[model samples]
Target: MPDTPAAPRFRSGAGRICLDFMRTLRLRGMDGATEELDTPEALAAWVAQLGPYPGGTKIPAPAEGVLGEARAVREAVYALLTAARSPAGPAGCPPKERGLLNRAAAAAPPVPVLDAAGSVTWTAGDPVGAVLADIARDALSLATSPALDRVRACSGPHCAAWFLDTSRPGNRRWCSMETCGNQAKKHAWRTRHATATAI
Candidate 1:
């Protein structure tokens, strides 16, 4: 039998659920924009990859309506963070987007259950929606918290993602050192070599 193909790998470790979800719409407001959650199956895949489910847990695909709502919530999250990070701050957000974000934040996130071994596992009646709810709530808290100042857009030339700069010096520039930072170092080396050769 033919082997089942693997699901596409999604990016993670943006320091916040909302920031990670925001990347589903890659290159937001920029050229070559791509939608990662284009279908219900894709939405389920995201939840399976990012949600707090145990290993090998199968995340059932949500309804088409749920996919739409997920996208809406993602946009609302982006809008809210944008406003909050701007000079005017969260107060600059108009009421409509704020309401959407607030409603999403109000959703029931995954609940924790402790087994006899004292192991904790997260459960949710609607896993996809629950993850999205956690994202919304995270965004709401992050936007209002003093940690908002720590948020920074990645300096990678090809990257448009944002991340919380937890570095003590507050000088982080890339989303992932393994990816963007390494690429930058190579580029800088090539440029220096070229300049030396020309001289």
Candidate 2:
């Protein structure tokens, strides 16, 4: 049997749902970008992975324009969060984007429920709306709360990913030490070794 394609790897280091949502725009550094949520099936799968939806809750397949709308909302949320972290105080969210978020936030909101193991999980009538609402709420909170100071864009070359610096020193620089951090370390080692060789 032919091997199945592996699912896209999402960056979870953002430490916030809204930031992670922004990460769906893959390879921001490259000319051609890969969109993780490119299809209705992909969207459905992504929603299912974000689980604790009621056992049999059926997520309606996204219609023609839904994916575009979702992407637009993600971009808006990204803009707002990045602006909050800017040296200058938070930039105002574009009116159209803000209005889009407001509509999503007003949709069927997610309900938190405790499972048998006593862990809190979420469920909603419309999975897409619920996820969007969650993202909107998170963005609003991060923008207004002191936590906004914790947001940091990764310093890796050609990397545009954002993450929350939860360290006591607040000095994080990479999205993930296992990935971009390691790459940076290797590059530095090569540079130092080359300099010594020249000497």
Candidate 3:
């Protein structure tokens, strides 16, 4: 048998977190996995399965306070994605909506938990800070980078994910064709066939 591959590790930072969450959403929804996570460890374990980061090491665990902050940011990202998917306002009015989305997407780093001595319980070992740095870079890139013409939420109902529309057509739909697009097509086909057979 082939050697069982180790899970992927994450580089300390927000991009890693974003990517991790995106994968989690995809796997839990599209892949037909029944594993239910009720705690942060579940999220961590899911990320661990992604294969090792460039270097095989665990991201330093966040201080208790940092965990809450990171969670908040993660939730905000999801909210922004959800809003973008709906045709409510953002799509109709680009400038104002983009500004609002940018503001929300700005995920601030959680302050480290400290002891009585004012020593931070979490340090460089904690990858949450690194994730924050990545978020900062990504936000700046989305704002100032001319290459980014359109940043929008994906069109898959099961996928509330965001991506820069780098395609020449600027009409990119799903976060990943293999994940959301393929799943949607398969479901539609199944429904059609099921109906035809019933008829």
Which ranges in model 3 have alpha carbons more than 4 Å from their true place? 6-53, 75-126, 144-148, 191-199
Give each model's whole-structure lDDT.
0.89, 0.77, 0.48
Give the RMSD in angstroms, all C-alphas superposed, for model 1. 2.5
Q: Whole-model lDDT, candidate 3?
A: 0.48
lDDT by residue (tens digit), candidate 2, 67-133: 8878887888876776666664455766777777777777777789888998886777677878878
Best by TM-score: 1
Question: If both were scored by TM-score, which would come out higher, candidate 1 or candidate 3?
Answer: 1
Give me the overall lDDT of model 1.
0.89
Tell me which of candidates 1 and 2 scores higher on TM-score: 1
TM-score for each of the candidates = 0.94, 0.84, 0.52
On residues 1-199, what C-alpha lDDT tens digit does candidate 1 reach at each position?
Answer: 9999775479998888889999898877788889999999999989998889886689999999999999998888888889999997988776888898888878899999999999999999999989988988998999999989999988888888998888999989999998889999999999999999999
Query: C-alpha displacement of 29 in model 3, angstroms?
Result: 15
Reference-based lDDT, residue 163, model 1: 89
The predicted structure with the larger lDDT, 1 or 3, is 1
